[model samples]
Target: MADVKVAVKILSELKSFVMQVASQEVVLDCFRRSNRDFTRNRKLPFDRLVLLIAKLCKKTLSIELEQFFKELGLENGCSVSAFTQQRIKLKASFFHWWNQVLWQSYYHYSGESTKRWKGLRVIAVDGSNISLLNTPALTKHFGGQSNSHGNFTQAKTFYYYDVLNELVLYPRIEPYRYGEVQMAYEGISQLSADMLVIYDRYFCSYKMFALHLWAEQPIPFIIRGNENQRMVKEFITSGKRSEIVQLAPTCPAIASLKKSGFIITPKTLLEVRLIRVELEKTVEVLVTNLTEANGYSDDQFKELYFLRWGVETNISVQKNIMQLESFSGLTVESVEQDFYATVFMANLHSVLIKDAQSTVNQLSKHKKYPMKVNRNKSFGKLKTSLVSLFIEHQPEQILLILHGHFIRDTLPVRKNRTFARIRKNKPGRSKHRTYSNYKPAC
Candidate 1:
């Protein structure tokens, strides 16, 4: 079990980092829309506003405003309109950089026990659609799909999730017109050789594979390939569990690469290994560069490929449990702020529970099903405690109280539980719609 003192130290470091960032006038200026924003002392200052957004505002704006100040032990709070005015002054990228510093601190202070698979950090790359308020400004900024009825406003999100650590390394919200593959390709600059990234079949492309291999430090990746593809079809028919093949870029792949300053001709072959994994209902082909025959065996590919599902589960949590689509403001800047702030808070919640999870594991080792902290409930507990955790002079007491709550309510992890996916036909209106007036009933 990790020492409770370690978690305490990490929490201290994170709070200090926040204080440091908020204190620097030069740093605050970079996140402001104009030089004059947040220059004067108003009801809401720069640091207070940053913490307010990180609180995961899912309630009515007015009520949330009142409660946020109340939590801080202050009787007075600003109005919703004032909050709206102040939030826009701050750029959304502030939360992005804030989350970057947060996870970096976690990895740094959490020590060497950070989870990895075969000495490599198993990072999963995936994308999901986020429902946004149907307004002219939002719709114009982020285009969405149309139907017989009308168009729905939405945005596409690409994420780099560290599945093992349950941290979102990068959370990006792009215009709905952008393809997931395009976003993934653009995100290649963030990848490192130490991480083994997993992708779904939608990300399978000749150019995508070449980009990883051509990086300054080649990144390792596993991409699920469509069975109908020529190479995959031939390999499937060969009946070999695994085989190394030379993949030649298609004309379109060549064109895309050439435009990106990576000149690849038709004869430019990318040597990749293809593995066949048998699922309960069917066999899936996985394209990868982990071709060492002994290092990663053909039999291990199935479980490694299955690890990609972690990202899918994480996305579901963001949508369902985290209420990620729940925006506090209507503008694009607010949307980005809410998105990145949620990522930061979620990562913090995950890290804070590590010690408690260890305690739960030790206590429930004899139980039939493996027990873990209930994340949905834990998030609520964390939300209420977040202010005190940062502001209290003695945060160790707050940490101890949080640790107790985390382990007190536990959920069982039932392995190999599968359910049929119910695919419903699209209705006249999107089943997933974000209302301008409704607040989440948490």
Candidate 2:
């Protein structure tokens, strides 16, 4: 993780940033706020938490956690006492706080939720299957998927949608071939009132739907149209070949309606709006309890329902782009520890990216405090860019850093990015231009 750490120039700024973010007072208060003492047997100081995070950043990579704890005995030329071993395990509680804090921060930045057709907040639910274990021992802890080669290995998680913010919440994680849907069912009991939950076709079942109604939750639902399901068809195209049609409910449970009411089940009549769209040479059918007169167009409802893609993209970033599957750790505890840590890091970076951009945007608008252009020079795989920037003359500076090489660039409040155009006639032109600048978001 140290390889991913901030450089000295950026570190100073990052320290100030972290202080604001994970300040000691905030950390302690948050820990105490949880109203639980993690280490009741022995007490330990806060520096241990700092060391754990620093080590995660790979600042002191070679030493094992305990060895490092022992090494910390000599930190600042003073010996830390014997009781710090319990500190290591207890410190993880603080990370839980950090996670919650960051989630709240990201939540604010994400956006606010909006209601679907009849003012029910819409939520899209889905899952991502992850390979948590391949080793034999790990398989005992986190089971695997089944296959011809071996029983396939993975953890599938059901994620509840907070679409406006593009964040997934209430994840129900379990092994493949069993338990995911069950866990999701148990977790769904916590859903808020008046929410419209859209489900993948696979989750459609009479038993689950029955549980929802029994709870008296009063939350409407939308799911894909299963071909085998029976329903009363309302408004069919008079002679149109397409099998799709818009409808209001005429179910047995909705007898009072005789035909006009809002009901999710066949018993209670529901006024519904259905849409079938052709995509990729395939017909896709959707069922909704919302009607056309509800002030939300079918097009708008469908567009909002499509927000599930964001969660899939998030999983892609975590497992594919972030190289999580490359993890070589074997223990289940360590793997989960690493997973939570990575989640925290990803959340932190997301917050930082937005924060940095917001800061630059606000300051850049002011005339007296123009943001500077920041040039990011990567050391490159073999440190070639660093060599050119450090050893070569000014002519090679642009050549070395150009062509897809990017470090985490930070733009100052005021700066320029004009490169020379063939040895300019004037010295000012040859040098950097104070007015012209690079991309601020770089």
Candidate 3:
């Protein structure tokens, strides 16, 4: 009951903030046109509600189908069957825009602002592939390649999210055959010059680097050590241990990165920094331009490269744990739409959990209470609360539930484990054919 009340409250809060940003008519029209929902005379929009439901269902359906329901307490109705059978499609752009909207809402509700690092928000770029339902339309479009399932092409997505801002980002998807580097290169157009783009070796391109340099913000790129033989020169020399120096060349890769310099267009140059670090098999000469003379020392450049970890973890949560692959779409377009929506939901939840924790921490100091907010509980509590309230249609009762309810650090459990997840679910024998009504997005 407490959980149900809280779910409703959070749903109400999401709805209220959504309305304040977009008109009800405009929002509904976008959904109707986008074909994300199945609505007939449905006055109020439940796009966020359904997305939250879908996320919960996807996150749990592979785990404990029964307990997933018990957690949400929707055994009698809104079962996994209902969620699947409904087959509501949200606009891919709706999720993209919602990503923007939620960031704004977080700013409004949480009353915390993210300051730009070095007068700019440093964002990073990377890509990962997720499995998708291989319906005829999907197979024809996203064509699965190979894995344990044998040649089901994964949906390759290019992502750009910021680590410092605590902001999650929406990924743009492309066909796997196109390659992640190609996908990442195309995604560079969406990035602004003001943003610092930290990337891996693959993204260091002559043409694309020049484009950011041309952009107003003078894009700064932090790419990894080059494997290309042409990029290698002698930075250090020893048997099996030779430090290679990358002299600044006429490469367009860091054009935007050197905007602070007097020369607007950096002559393609190789910058080398001497450092010792161990890789798996062997530790060889590493070369980076980050030096004591430049703003960054040998250590800071390595630290910047390490920022790459944030994107890796984000992709893991979205793919392995969040079950983002088990989305409710048969077509690649629909899958893309759901993919972004899931991202928005995750980011929104991140903000909520952060805020809840901050609130508890503040109160804890005053009350001398040891209570702190647990991430799982904070996320679970908000999500579970939204499911019940929206389904029950009692938006007004939200505040009462949150009143005086402290976000607890400890999640509820029965000696199972800390931050327990249900074991991997094995599918029962069922017809492999997709629903006949399924149609591809045009």
**Candidate 1: tens digits of C-alpha lDDT, residues 350-384:** 88888899999999989999999988788888888
Every model's TM-score:
0.95, 0.54, 0.64
TM-score of 3: 0.64
Q: Which runs of model 3 end up more than 4 angstroms from their true locations?
A: 1-29, 34-39, 43-55, 59-89, 107-116, 147-149, 233-294, 356-377, 388-442
Winner of 2 and 3 under TM-score: 3
Taking the tens digit of each residue's C-alpha lDDT, what string does model 2 give over 1-442? Answer: 1112212223233333345433455545554324244324322334344334423322223244444444444333212333233332433344444455555544443334222435555667777677654677667766876766557467665666555433444544455655655665676677766677787667655444544544555556666655455531222223222233333334443443233232355543223445554445555556665545556455664565565565665565555434444342455544554455445544443432333343445556855655522322221211222222222234133332332233234444433345457643533423122222221111
Q: How accurate is candidate 1 locally (lDDT)?
A: 0.85
- Local error of candidate 3 at residue 161 (angstroms): 1.5
The lowest-lDDT stretch of 10 consecutive residues in candidate 3 is 433-442
- Go through the candidates in order and give the C-alpha RMSD of each one to the true structure: 2.8, 14.9, 9.3
Clash count of each predicted structure: 0, 21, 32
Across residues 245-310, which tens digit of lDDT does each residue of candidate 3 receive?
444535343543454242534544443344544455654334433345546544454455667677
lDDT, candidate 3, at 403: 29
lDDT, residue 139, model 2 = 79
